[model samples]
Target: MTAFEATRAWAEAQDAADPLRAFRDEFHIPAHAGADTLYFCGNSLGLQPKGVRAAIEAELSDWAELAVEAHFRGRLPWMHYHEYVRDAMAEVVGARPHEVVAMNSLGANLHLMMVSFYRPTAERSAILMEAGAFPTDRYALESQVRFHGFDPSRDLIELQPDGPGGTLSMTAIERAIAEHGHRVALILLPGVQYRTGQVFDLEAIVRLGHAQGCVVGFDLAHAVGNLPLALHDAGPDFAVWCTYKYLNAGPGAVAGAFVHERHARADLPRFAGWWGHDKSTRFQMGPHFSPTPGADGWQLSNPPILALAPLRASLNVFTRSGMARLVEKSRRLTAYLDWLIRTRLDDTLDIVTPDDPTQRGAQLSIRVRAGRDAGRSLFEHLERHGVIGDWREPDVIRLSPVPLYNRYADCFGAVEAIEAWVR
Candidate 1:
């Protein structure tokens, strides 16, 4: 890796040589003071892709011309709208086409996956998850435990970080599963930790949990487009993710789910709905429910064509850029940001995200050393100076340099703004 220099010239040089630099022009950067804001908030909501409007408008045109017939007749036909994005989405997440599907929201998909994979016997009913997981995950686990006639306090195991610098280690994770393996029915974790920006080893987690007779799953909301994943080979029972973050999909876009190919014919219990019925006989109105064999079998209703159009557009961008290339750039881009902070704002800020690039994505969760009030002030200061980053509750401010659209110059400019606030 090249050593980073804390200068705008160095930043511009990196951006000048960046092969992915042209991709930045594809997004609509938010404005501040008559110029584009330094957007480091793709970890929250991604900037709108310039192609999204046309994507949405295409569907609208079909609707106007074809109406109800548009389901089977259109540029991209609504009947199999989810399928339109499946191959590209699978490519992004590293899964087979049949193994991935664009469907319900993240929370809803989590619940549906839990229904099939969280079947608990009296002897093996506990769920092991990381401590301080996102609130939505925590709530879902709690409710699932209660619904199954178990006490969450006793059945839910929150794994803590025992590695150096308060990060979870493979040793710690292995030890936790070993100790709780006998009583654990399921293990759910994030591909990337939301608050700290720690990327877990998905393959290792699957190996550990499966070795212990546990059904493992992942919430990849933070990992999906930010990192290249191999969910198929990693062999998780299931994985769920939202497309709006690093995917550059619009707000509240339809989410996705992945089910391993091994479960294609398994007689697992699932929440049945009409949309999941066998396509060949779906309109026959058969009284019996026969699921569509793969991840698509998990659908509860027909996909929202309009919501999926933007996702289609965004996935096309990802397809064109390729995850491997994007990730390579992400490492360098984030490392530049890290370099700037260490050199310029070390006295006032601390990076909660790991220094090791492999252990994180594009996001760097920064902690203000001057305390919460000072942190809030610093965040607002950055906002005033045309820098856009998100402040998590308490003290951390998340700055993510998305490879698809963010440049090295954005990282440098953002750090400069933070330095000004400190001065």
Candidate 2:
């Protein structure tokens, strides 16, 4: 057999040996002709669980039969729909239910969090973020600083990479904190950076920020369901993440926010909408703005149950698997990917993410050496060959092997594809 045929046979044999191979049946894997597509884009849009279709259809039925009454009378009443998700979301982030709430989209939620936490005094008005954070986050921080009358060009402190195409150094991070911590109102970072896949030490950052009186928050768009997170223990003033990525929720699903319990009754300033009102008196609807107790107080509008439905379906599986066991699987799966890449693809590729599993999730960033079109070229190559991965601008390709649905053989196949492409 040719190398490609041998590779295919190897994939089959490994799949046959996989313990989690059955979980693939839980998803409707995309197919063309008789073969399944090799899907690694779960870092961007996770494949739908077979159960999600039915969960969503059930909502549609309730909508058809009950109409607006679905708000209060459906099987899962819309009036308290967000409640159904509260505990599960809390579990995903390791927070108490009261400290967590499903709200707007990721960017919108970040802005809401900013309004409540990014209180800049003239003396400490700068915002600190890693250079090359997700564009949305950079835009969010810029607008936030400018809105508060600070000049982003100077006040938005971006910690650039320490050397030529190298990662950010912990020493540099701490030095910046020590030098500018007093002049910074907030420190914003991704729990797992989108481009480089670098995982920040949230607790260490938070502890340091608090010592310097700087509020810390995370754009967990990449970290939420990918790794083990204890948002409460991390003690960030706030955090926001979307559900579409690792949670297997549908595209544009509602996002979640973690507001530490200390913020629960602190009279923190917020930009509120009707949904943030006290549930007990929400129907009372007189002329007064009474707030819900915790993270719910940060909400601005009613949730989209259509969006919530898939998240619910995904969370049910997570609840069953338990975060601890799933994280164990994630570590091994990503470790195997790292091992394969280092062992096979390193000569032609630069692995940009951190070397430590404790410093990343499932996504591995590959910097192809074939020039500016490398990201796009490699992306198309993978797709045409039936391997899927996400690409960032310039020359970075990201592959994530998700815990719930990814198999050990999938890891090996992806690495083989990368090696084949490079050679």
Q: What is the alpha-carbon lDDT of model 2 when measured against the actual structure?
A: 0.84
CA RMSD for every model? 1.0, 3.2
- Best-fitting candidate, measured by lDDT? 1
TM-score, every prediction: 0.98, 0.94
Our model 1 lands, by Cα RMSD against the true structure, at: 1.0
Question: Where does candidate 1 clash, by residue pair?
Answer: none
lDDT of 2 by residue, 46-95 (tens): 99988998888888999999999999899999888888888998998999
lDDT of 1 by residue, 282-382 (tens): 99998999999999899989999999999999999998999999999999899889988988888888899999888999999988887999999999999
lDDT of each: 0.92, 0.84
Reference-based lDDT, residue 358, model 1: 87
Give stretches of model 1 more than 4 Å off: 164-166
